[model samples]
Target chain A: EPEVTQTPSHQVTQMGQEVILHCVPISNHLYFYWYRQILGQKVEFLVSFYNNEISEKSEIFDDQFSVERPDGSNFTLKIRSTKLEDSAMYFCASSEGTGRGGRPGELFFGEGSRLTVL
Target chain B: AQKVTQAQTEISVVEKEDVTLDCVYETRDTTYYLFWYKQPPSGELVFLIRRNSFDEQNEISGRYSWNFQKSTSSFNFTITASQVVDSAVYFCALSDFNRDDKIIFGKGTRLHILP
Candidate 1:
């Protein structure tokens, strides 16, 4: 089956440094999202992207965070200045369409990229 | 506000034992969705099941079954005759159709199936 793929299975960066995580969503998917999970914490939604723009974002997705679909296939998340709290596992997910409440769309998630900030 | 709660932090069961993971959610949207994902030791999340607000019908797939109770706002998963391969973290999630925000995951329940 086709699956979402993420680059840099693991990354370690110093505080105040920049880090970019890449993901290639399923070719036919129309909606993309970024989520993070701190160690021993629940997964938190970061942002959702559709039609080349962010559809929604959480408080955790502040100015320092940005997402881009530079190319048709590549979706990237960039943290301008990483903080220690940024250390977590970032997941990339995508869905083809959002159906009604009776048949909501299901997301396909990538393995995840583990980010470590020192 | 939409929130998902997985009260059981961790659960252990011997091989062949049946186990249930509890999940409760709070959502104001009349139209919403609930989901379950499994994270194996390899740290990869696998989608297990998705239940929408309109469908309260319980479903069973092989040894895995899901109970969706709209009255209590709870969606629970049960694994029967569990095997060693079933050891992993299971997460219950909620999403509102009225909003563009992504699914919200609860603190996962780590399941350890001892041999």
Candidate 2:
């Protein structure tokens, strides 16, 4: 089955540095999302994007985090300044749905990008 | 506010045993969908099942079954004759049908099956 793909399966960067995590969602999907999980922690929602605008976001997705679909296939999440708390495995997910409710969409997730900040 | 809770942090069973994982969720959206996923040691999230708000019908697929109760806000999963391969972290997720939002996950329940 076709699946979402993420680049740099693992990333290590210095604190206060900028890092851009890349993801290519499944083709023909309309919605995309970013989530992160610290070691042995629950996966936390970051942001959701649809139709070129951010549909919704969580507090974990603060000003330091931004997402853009710069191209047709690339969905990138950039952290302007990384912190120790930013170290986690980031996952990208996509879904196929157009309008509203009643179980219209199901999300498929990527393998995830492991980020380690020192 | 929406929160998905899986109280059982870890469960262990022998091979060929039947096990059930409990998941209770709290969501303001009366209309939503419930999902179950498995994450193995590889850190990959595997989709297992999805149940809509309107559908209270219980479903059974292979060795897996799900019980969706709107009254209790609980969606529980069962594995019959579980095997060693069934060992993994199971997560319960909820998604309000806004069409463009992401699914929120509960703290996963880790299952360990001994051979």
Best by lDDT: 1
Q: List the residue pairs that clash in candidate 2.
A: none
Model 2: residues >4 Å from true position, as ranges?
A98-105
Distance (Å) between predicted and true CA of A6, model 1? 0.8
lDDT of 1 by residue, B1-115 (tens): 8899999999999999999999999998998889999988887678898888999999999999999999999999999999999999999999886553478899999999999
Residues A64-115, candidate 1, lDDT per residue (tens digit)?
Answer: 9999999989999999999999999999988886663323447888999999
* Per-residue alpha-carbon lDDT of candidate 2 for residues A1-118, written as tens digits (9 for 90 to 100): 9999998899999999999999999898888889998988788889999899898899888999999999899999999999999999999988876336323446788999999999
Question: Model 2 has how many clashing residue pairs?
Answer: 0
| Residue A94 accuracy (lDDT) in model 1 | 88
Reference-based TM-score, model 2: 0.95
Worst 10 residues of 1 chain A by lDDT: A97-106
Worst 10 residues of 2 chain B by lDDT: B94-103
Candidate 2 chain A: worst 10 consecutive residues by lDDT? A97-106
Kept native contacts, fraction for each prediction: 0.54, 0.56
